[model samples]
Target: MSEEKGLLHGVWETVKTVVYALLIAGAFRTFLFQPFWIPSGSMKDTLLIGDFLFVNKMAYGYSYASCPSIRIPAVGIDISAEDFCGVFKGSDSRLFGSEPERGDVVVFRHPTRGDDFIKRMIGLPGDRIQMIDGVLQINGEAVIIEEDGFFIETYEQQGPLGNTPMCMNGSVGIGGDCMKERMYETLPNGVRHAILNARDDNPRPFTDNSGVYVVPEGEYFLMGDNRDNSGDSRVPATQRGVGFVPLEDIVGRADRIMFSSAGRSMFAFWTWRSDRFFKAIE
Candidate 1:
């Protein structure tokens, strides 16, 4: 009988410890930094697929989107940020709000899908933005773009999604060289970063050239570093693209990459990109 009581007490103590640990972890994730894994090649070269980073949630203050979304398909758990902090939503303001500077890489919630997205902040509220002949134009002036050679990779399956990269050097068989025209683009604020163009010769009419977008107040314009391949503010939200994202949707700034893997799974230890560990984002 004494043994049974001892076993029950030990189980209860273990359960309490697990509960306490989960609560502490939840608070840390909610109020401080949140771990984010790059899942797409949109920010390539700058932020490659499988790159993992911790977003600084305190950078822009707390918003409803700051709450982490928990999604585990295998266990059938799918909770959105709205589910956790829906009451704090429905407004364009954030608690302890701070404006984000141009060229800062940010992770935010998708306006339509509520999924997380990371991109470089290109236009602030009330900024006139456009794309002319594959060049970024802000406030009636074109940003400077200096040619920076090429970004080359193997024309094969990449990351867990098994997506092939779009290449500037036309069609290539699997395992062949895939390349993109890389350039350093200087924003109006003097912040410069590398941008990739997959189709330099045949620029897309919609992406390379677009009508002027006067970003409304409390909204921001963001774009991927891989310019031609990104479906960003240039495209409308109705067309499955990230249009003008509200200020409240801004989650946090991605300051640095914690880890990176070139293979399909990060668990494949041999595929780790050791050089990219703790790499700073420009």
Candidate 2:
């Protein structure tokens, strides 16, 4: 049975190779970078629903929760990590890397929720933020806003037919366009970005005017590019909106779009967003 012994040895070697490769890949994803997918329109006009990007984990230093050094079982071989670490502080600060700057797009763990979220950093520690009649004011000064045109997108099969947020002004995208209000907002830090005004000047009391919030140290205030539709710092996390984000929760900054596909599966080549691929997230 010498021939049978040889075949078994060859198979064992192949399995070992695959396991080693996966271990290396897992370490890279946990320590250096991680792929992230945009699943909602919260950061619309900048980050689309089908957009894929990389979150630079190294930019914010290592945190237990950011990328827990864990293992994945491969081919019956338990590549178990002996040590796993993360932070679960009621409030905490960064461990090593630089702090998140204003206007930077960020990904973080939801303070009181189960999933991770991506949003724009609008207010830092000790900054006063408010929205008055659809205008954003920071530290008692109104941020600049310039009206642009409209942001239109085709409704996917999952989108509702009418009387919904996506189907704004029913038959808008199909007949003509899903006319969403567009504006270029300039942050206090001189960072300018596009924001969507889906509500068409209709101000919701809860979000449109949030009666001045003075951001506390070790926390941040975030918002979405889709101003009217996003559930951001303006709404409490208890209500499914991201509340004051603790600094320790931030995972990384999203710098560019890796690739995107309109189809439900990543393998759908026909639905690729070629134009947005490799595009820098501004």
Candidate 3:
């Protein structure tokens, strides 16, 4: 009987350790760094599908983890904490006091369903943002674009073509269809980042039909670097795209890409793309 009791105690201790470890990990993920996966091509050529990234939770401030909350052991969930933290403690602006600036890559909850979304800030409160003739302009000033560098393209032929010879700019060396246009964009606050534009087609009509929207206070306008393809604030509010993200809806800021994979199938370790790993999100 004593032996059975000892064995039971050992099992309990092991379970306790596992629970404690999980709690610690959850706390760390909630407060410090959280991992997210890119499931869409909206930010393509910048962040690809199957890319795993780390978001810096501290970039803004604590939301709920820092406050007191009721924790259930077996359930592994926080019951309630917002009210205990303070009326507006976990609300929005905390003492840390950092506001989302233009050009800063941010992750916020979708206004429609509260799902997390990652995008770059383009327009701030009171800023007039309009896309004219395919070029992004802020307050009637055209955004500047500068060339950064170029890349190489590799190809393989199948069937009767067999293995085709790789070509460069003309027919065999660096500068053919591989040349990509890179530009530097400076935000209203002077924050600058490199942006890529690969589309050669003329700019489509501005999808934003709100008629010269003046961003209201406590809200922001966001757009993906793949401007031509992204569904952002520029779209009408009636649509499913992000119309405007409120200050409180922001979850955190994307700090860096931890790991990335090119093709689908998460289980295929051999298919992981190593080149994109640890790449900073510009």
Candidate 4:
């Protein structure tokens, strides 16, 4: 049989080299860079909890939230981004779009829990946005901050969902020493980041005083620079928060931090962090 036709032509050339390396890694993760895996700290100390980052999908272009969404909930495989481009989603129009300034650090697509959510942008379209006592005002002024002080850590569990981290030198007993109140802010076209503040003595914590918002036009306005724990857009999206998002659910712009892993298993490479590897993401 001619050695079974040379072992079926060497298993059909190793299945066409694993289907051309999975179609060139699925067209380079569907039109360039996607990865992203911070798992939450809500952009703390500028995106922590595990870090990993990629998400540049041409920095705000394609639509249907730039497709690519596989979500592996312990083998369940959720799959979203409207199941890979839901007829290019209700049309907030994208495909080559571009416009997402106010302090960058994006990564969207959760207009209704379609998953992915990194933040930062902070109001745009029509602007307005509020939050008095805890600072960030915009369109009515007040975005400066300054006092960059404490941020400390290790009050025990963190990452891999262990959570626990809101402290202004409060309760912390699990291995003690935690804090918060770091400032910096700036944003008024001048960027400047770092903003955390765990309870500046409440002063009326409705996300520290809100109710202004506005920002409609094409929709934008994100948050979570750890501002008192961040649920963002000051809360609404039917209450769970992350309200005014859609700019076709903007899925892009995260800039750097190739890997970080503070522990709970990112293969636990000695719990990495190595000065946050590629870092950048400011």
Best by lDDT: 1
Worst 10 residues of 1 by lDDT: 200-209
Against the reference, the lDDT scores of all candidates come to 0.92, 0.78, 0.65, 0.84
Candidate 4 C-alpha lDDT tens digits along 44-137: 9988888887888897788887878887899998988788788878896787888888899898877877788888898899999898878889
**Which tens-of-lDDT digit does each residue in 182-213 have in candidate 3?**
55666656776755444555254563223465
Off by over 4 Å in 1: 201-203
Q: Encode model 2's per-residue lDDT on 1-282: one tens digit a residue.
A: 599999999999999999999999878887878777887788988997778999998787756546533333454543211134432344354567578899999988777653578999999999999988789999999999999988876654521112223544555544355668789999988999999877744556755676999899888999999987888998889987888988777878899998987666778788788999899998
Please estimate how well model 1 matches the true structure, expressed as its whole-model Cα lDDT. Answer: 0.92
Scored against the true structure, residue 264 in model 2 reaches a CA lDDT of: 69
- Candidate 1, residue 59: Cα displacement in angstroms equals 0.5
Which segments of model 2 are wrong by more than 4 Å? 68-93, 158-176, 201-203
CA lDDT for candidate 2: 0.78
lDDT of 2 at 226: 90
Q: What is the C-alpha local distance difference test score of candidate 3?
A: 0.65
**What is candidate 1's CA lDDT for residue 216?**
97
lDDT of 1 by residue, 1-282 (tens): 699999999999999999999999999999999999988889988999889999999999999999989999889999999999999897767888899999999999988988999999999999999989899999999999999999999998889888888998999989899999999999999999999989866556767888999999999999999987887887877786899999999999999999999899999999899999999999
Cα lDDT of model 4 overall?
0.84
